[model samples]
Target: MERGLTNRKEVAKLAGVSEATVSRVLNGIGPMKETTRERVLQAARQLNYELNAVASSFARGRSGNLGVVLPHVPKVHLFSTYYFSELLGGIGEAVHAKGYGLLLLFRDPSEAYDYVSLYRTQRVDACIILGSSAIDTERDAVHRLAEERLPYCVMDQRFDHPQLNIVAADHEQGSYEAVKHLIDKGCRHIGFLNGSPQYSNSGDRLTGYRRALSEAGIPWDEAAVYEGNYSRTSGKKAAALVYRDLERLDGIFVGNDRMAIGLMQGLRELGCRLPEDLKVVAYDNSDAASFTEPPLTTVKVPFYDMGKLAAERLLRVLADKASDPCPQIKEKLPTELVIRKSSGN
Candidate 1:
């Protein structure tokens, strides 16, 4: 056997621990009891073990890799979507420029969120999370990470954790401006089509919609609010409800471009004309938004910038913790309302 390998095995045997434990103790991966760490070190000394440069670096608890945790939805091509593509582009740019490796980790929303395992296993030094919601399991996982003080950031998600570093867009302001724009265009009875209830941004949009109606002196109608899963199919399904209330509604504020596109298509198929019958505004300002029959008046969110900022901030801390040891950054970037023919502008 090679001398280094023999020394490693001997040290593990002398310490009465597995070889994996000896490797972890030497590499500083995960959490280890002080007694176990001491025993491993004493065994290494007895065997006259010497660590190479790479092993020494690992022993210091840094893997020279930045991890990005993504939601693993079956059959969902995340890279093709504008939201995911833009965010990944930004994150990729930051990691590349920083001379650090980018590690992709996928987690099923249905399964347990074990983000700390990546840190403990020495797979990555820091990480960024995407597609998180208000799920209780997610919240508990984040709380555990917070307690550990692991370097990580969550993009475009809001949690109850006070110590979490989050970079998210101002969806409330965006939704408010969308509805307010419709109101300014003489829409007295406007309807709002929102995304899933699981997302925090969904609540923010609803709050904005209500605020706009209250400020405009328009009576809130329970039927005016519609729900969708942020998919074009849901938007198409919502068209039936919108058609039923077509006579009462003069405008609609949609949560996203995909849903808005579907709603418009379904309404058009049912002989409802855009702007002529109902003015509409949407969010996300996706690439297809501009190509709609009547170009969509949508809210443009800074998702790319949000991803970039989150990565840069977290990487900066990893590079120099002494400068900014505890990064409790909470930022909300502004969203812009783009005017187009759909809003009757």
Candidate 2:
């Protein structure tokens, strides 16, 4: 029985392998025979040896972990809002399979910038910024990370940062297609339920909505646009406002699914029949969208794919392969417009 700190050398000695071999096996690098790998692992376990993650990472010139920063999580709507969770799930699965760890950091813009500062001082190999608006507001933090030369990727957002990689859904195209679907279904007076106008997504979606209306020869009415926070409560409130002018609106395109669900509920309470009296379309085909009274017609953002893409991009940057044609990539995955009962299609 070995005593004291069980370092890699001691484990290698017990496993009858060189210290370098132990390093390779532990770090998941060079191919050691299965038998040899297993023996080294068992010896480390028996000796209660824990590899120094930081030291190992430094030696390899990489940290086997990725840091993800997201907006503050709402207490009531944890799983209902699938944006962060779906992205995190995809990132977790992908990185775990690749023998890496994921450190999820949830904070508002202020705290998020602080975390980025602390991360720079520490040993994180790379990071992913979640939302475009939040990223833009935290540009100073982003610049700090840039100065440190930490590999980072932006998810679900676009920015003009030269060094930051980005993976996002084509929101403009998706919104255009969604509104177009409603127009094709004989809806003329369509309204838009939008998130903050300050966001890039809101601006792009607004553009899409206008484009669709213009192409359909339907006059765009600015009065029909109702701005709301991205939440079911806000959606419901926005819908009530739209309902006040119900005589002027026959359809709606909501920014996200949760708000869409709230809109539907509001309309129903106001005695408006869905699809029959008013049609609705939304973005982010979250789980709740599918179970709505009349299954929601939505544009499905490929959240899982986006997360995986972000992780892969970050890994490439961390590996100092930014110049690799593969890492310098920006992908705008297409969104699918899932037709359901809500849009009367």
Candidate 3:
């Protein structure tokens, strides 16, 4: 009935299975049959049997923990961001369902951190890296982890390594659809406010934007493209840079919802009308996008789903290592176009 008092013998007796079966089911080691595994698990639940994590880890040579790495930035709130919060929520759900512990760590971009050390130190059985950039030091760390053949995954980032696991959204297609929607609205001379090139998604969005223009027989104007930092302030700054040619600009495609909202605010202050003067579309379908003055039409990226998939893929990798090696997997999820009043639709 109690933690220390309940033993495997009683569990096996209740489930009508051998003690070894109970051990296998509890430790998640060895192959298991469906009906037998369920019976053992149910008996354990009914008896409130708790396995000794330390003993099991010693036997399995694992920590039974998953590592989640995030970037540490001064003066920045991590959880408040819509993107990271959704991602964490999804990862937490998957980790809980698998009955594994989560170890969250943050490292400064300017400093050095060895990702493979987590596995070597027995702190985590696997790792998931989030919010990756094209920084040289970060790329080096990823390469080191891959070279060591560690079980890990990177969310929303892609590397050229054949063995690296990646889960990301199809940003290029999403961007193309958003731009096409704007073009369908008879909006010509569309301006673009894009994020920094450090992230691959930013580059993909740029490619999609150019492709859409080329398909529609519109000339690409270098002066109409403004680079933003995926922030509201940057969006406001982008508005000023395009203001001199605002008269000729009929629509705009922003990189993210935060920037889209800021661009709206900037346009309002600059004596511009919504949808009537300048139609707008953005990406990331964040919560604030819906509550804007005229709800923004944006690309809805499945961050939560991608996080869950990444965690699931990492768990599979850890399991496969016990028997045979698993091949590297790269999954690209699709996005949806959420039309709202901001795009005049």
lDDT score, residue 252, model 2? 91
Q: What is the per-residue lDDT of model 2 for residues 207-315, given as tens digits with 9 covering 90 to 100? A: 9999999999998898999988778899898867887988888899999998988888888999988878788999999988889899999999999888988787677
TM-scores for every candidate against the unseen true structure = 0.83, 0.80, 0.84
lDDT by residue (tens digit), candidate 3, 1-345 = 112324788898999999876766776553468798789878887877763542443354566688999999887787777789889888888988877788899988787778977877777888889888888888888888877777788888877777777889999999999999999999889999999889999999988999999999999998888899887889888877767778889999999998888888988899888988899999999899889989999999999998888888887776553522445768999999999999997
Those runs of model 1 whose alpha carbons end farther than 4 Å from true positions after fitting are 1-58, 323-325
What residue runs in model 2 are displaced by over 4 Å at the alpha carbon? Answer: 1-21, 24-61, 73-80, 111-119, 132-137, 146-149, 319-329
Rank all candidate structures by their TM-score, best first, as comma-separated numbers. 3, 1, 2
Best by lDDT: 1
Quote the positional error of residue 125 for candidate 1 in Å.
Answer: 1.5
The TM-score of predicted model 1 comes to: 0.83
Q: Candidate 3: global Cα-lDDT? A: 0.83
Per-residue lDDT value at 53 in model 1: 29
Q: Each prediction's Cα lDDT score?
A: 0.85, 0.76, 0.83
